[model samples]
Target: MSAAVSTILPIEADQSKPAADPRDLLLHSIYEPDRDIQGLTARELEIIFQAYKKKDLANVPVRKAPSYSEAEQSALELWRQQVNHHMTMRISRYSMGCVSRQHKTSVSPAPRPINRTEHQVFQIPELLDLILSFAGPQVQIRAQQVSTNWRFSAISVISNPKNMETFRSLAPLPPVEYGQLLDDTTRSLPEPDSQQIEQFGLHVDHMVSWWRKLYRRRYVYFPAKLAQRDDLPNGIAQSLNELDVGQRHGDYHGSIHTVSRTTDLYWLDLSQFQINPYFDLLFSEKGRMLHRLGRWEIGLRSNATSETLVLDDSSSEKLLVQAVGSMHITNPPCRSLGIYCYDNCVFPMHGTHILLRRIRNSNGIRVAELLDALQSCAPQLLTKWVKCAEHLRRNVTETGHWVDSVWLIPGTPRFRIHLDNCDMSDEVSYATAVWTPEMARDAETLIGASLGYQAHITRTAYMSAEPPRATKEGEWLPEELFEPMKTECGRSNINWDA
Candidate 1:
């Protein structure tokens, strides 16, 4: 063991021998030029190759070289530069993409503002006028609430004088310019043409407010104000084609005389006003000024059972006759006349027919007096006329048993007879007069024929009766007088005087 120890210690290998260059080893590990390295880098490939080669090479460690071969060093330098360049490019591209996305997200189009000028170009007044023309009454009022512009437009359109005229022209006659007048009063401003405000329609509250204002100004009559305010838009006098003065009760009366005098009204519906004493004022000397009148409707408060006598001495009929007759004599010749005896349920036989005949024959004087005198001259004619009378009476009945009958007779002088209370009783009998006593004899013959028709009707009624009559047909007095008159009995060619 001593001899071995002395000699074997000298067998130490050369530890100072030069080590293989690490760069050369690294190059050798990745030296395969034909090898395909896709996602893996050169360093990763080298690591993998060295890991596998390590088993075959034993535990020998590679040496660190001071420098590398030209080809190996170049390849290494190129690889490092390529990696750095790719990273830099990728960072630049990512930053550019992020900026582009942010720019797209942040950008937005500007919102447009409402153009007042464009709106004004359509002309607010014209727009409002169009709206009123196309829209109904409710829409006109509702348009005011749409916006401040709409409100202003509506007011301006209604208040403007020219626009008001257009509105009036568009209205059906008797033209109503109520909306224009209302706009003027609501703003507390004098209307542009007050004379044009002939007919007005106001809400209940608004009418009260207007009355109060007018009363404060000591306006005794609406007509005078109408004439004075000619410059006012839609004045009462100028626009006065038809006047409707509404009142809640029959006791109400208006100073319509002055208004009628100043206005050219064709129809006057004073249905809200009372008849009795107020009617006296209406048909007074001053009130008779309504010469243009074509139709008149006035309300009465009298009961059905009440006897409303319109005697020739002093009655609305006489006043109306005088008023209408005077107008007829003046030669303009009024064609149509309508009298609505509202609430006056009792129908006066003599007065109503006389009035109707007078109004009908006013233009032709030849028929006027003849018609008037016929009232007393023919008692049989009166009985025959009872049908018309009964018809007129039934019209205003509360029970609605009889309805008004209107007939339009077509001829050169066309006439319309409106029976307020029409009766359809088959039991009513009538008599008619003929030219001479001989013609009267012929009428009796016609009556005899008419009686024959009645016989059949009576026989039918007797058969249907619950308890049959004991009397035989021959035993009975024929019941001819009780039968309805022929239809011809209702027709007459005789012209009656007014």
Candidate 2:
């Protein structure tokens, strides 16, 4: 007989004695707990257990009764389920083994190799680099893990500086709310206060809030005027026009403009200009228009460097987003600033947008406050803003959704995107003009619009030619937009104007 048949074949019971009680049989097996009964092996004990399972001890009534509690019954049922699961697995494995053995014996001796050439084509340096450059950072890192060749190929391709440009070129164009003005055929614009730029520019806090807002957005003259100042010396005012400042090429006329917060940008001026400097529109190949607001600045560089500092425009924005995002998720103290700084890949320049030192010292600030301020002043940037927030929250904090304080400077420019904590006594006082010549020029235009939007609502109301006038005093203002915002600001003892 086979070993399996010999082990499982039943022994005929003698017809003289009564059948053994199932309870006594179970008691005999478990009474000692540790000492093996009759020196039975694991397989022998399993056979006896299987016999009890087949008889269904759960339903069988014992003459010598010991009833089980509900808890005990539930536990017993769960244990039975587990045993059943194991049995099913064992049967499946045995069946699979038999089928595999049979298959091996009957199959052909020679098997055709899979066509790896199709998969191998992706490893081609040029094609792989191009494809990988289009993927987000997360996907690129994962692709590197597939094989040694892939890691080498991905590392080399992603490391190239040229891929940055390719990434930008290939990315979907940003949504432009105000840039549409640049395209419309109407010579006369919808009323200044009625415009999207004016509505988004209503915040009273930062100089960026009111400073860049246009007095007039007659698209015809604005672009031309901005272009003229490209040669102007120290003409930061040209930024007001949202003109492309960096290097330009035939294939690409200029960089894209965006209002979203998550983008990789060269410059960002917070003042009233609707197409805020970095957020300005770009007229690219064949009049292609797109926003630059929410894109991340993926300026790739090799990791094998020491004492490295890179002059990147968006690094400050990236790190600030990271820092604020980190604080939101981790709820850590100021020391956590070091971790954020270290993760930035490069040391950001001071006064570029936000300084690491200033953030480290800012115990009074909260990431929510930063986000709230952005939403109030520039709601369009919120999605990318939150993306940056979540990225830092998950990666640095190693958690999701937390809150904490951070350092911030008090008051300057319209937008509070950056804060300065210069020591008042130690810092040298200079007789610097409050507004630069360009700023002063932009201010005149902004003041005119502000007065019209605020105090002159009555005057413009009766005119049928214009859209509906701003209904109340400071009616178009951000403070008036939502009641909760005003209440929160009030609780914080912060003056929106101040």
Candidate achieving the largest TM-score: 2
Q: What RMSD, rounded to one decimal, does every model reach?
A: 51.2, 31.3
Angstrom error of the Cα, residue 439, model 2: value is: 34
Q: Estimate the overall C-alpha local distance difference test score of candidate 1.
A: 0.27
* Cα lDDT computed for each candidate against the true fold: 0.27, 0.28
* Residue 475 error, candidate 2, Å: 32
* C-alpha lDDT of candidate 2 relative to the true structure: 0.28
The TM-scores of all predictions, comma-separated, are: 0.17, 0.19
Off by over 4 Å in 1: 1-309, 312-332, 340-358, 361-498
Candidate 1 accuracy as TM-score = 0.17
The alpha-carbon deviation from the true structure for residue 40 of candidate 1, after best TM-score superposition, in angstroms, is 87
lDDT of 1 by residue, 212-263 (tens): 4431111111222232232333433323212223211112223332233322
Model 2 RMSD, rounded to 1 decimal = 31.3
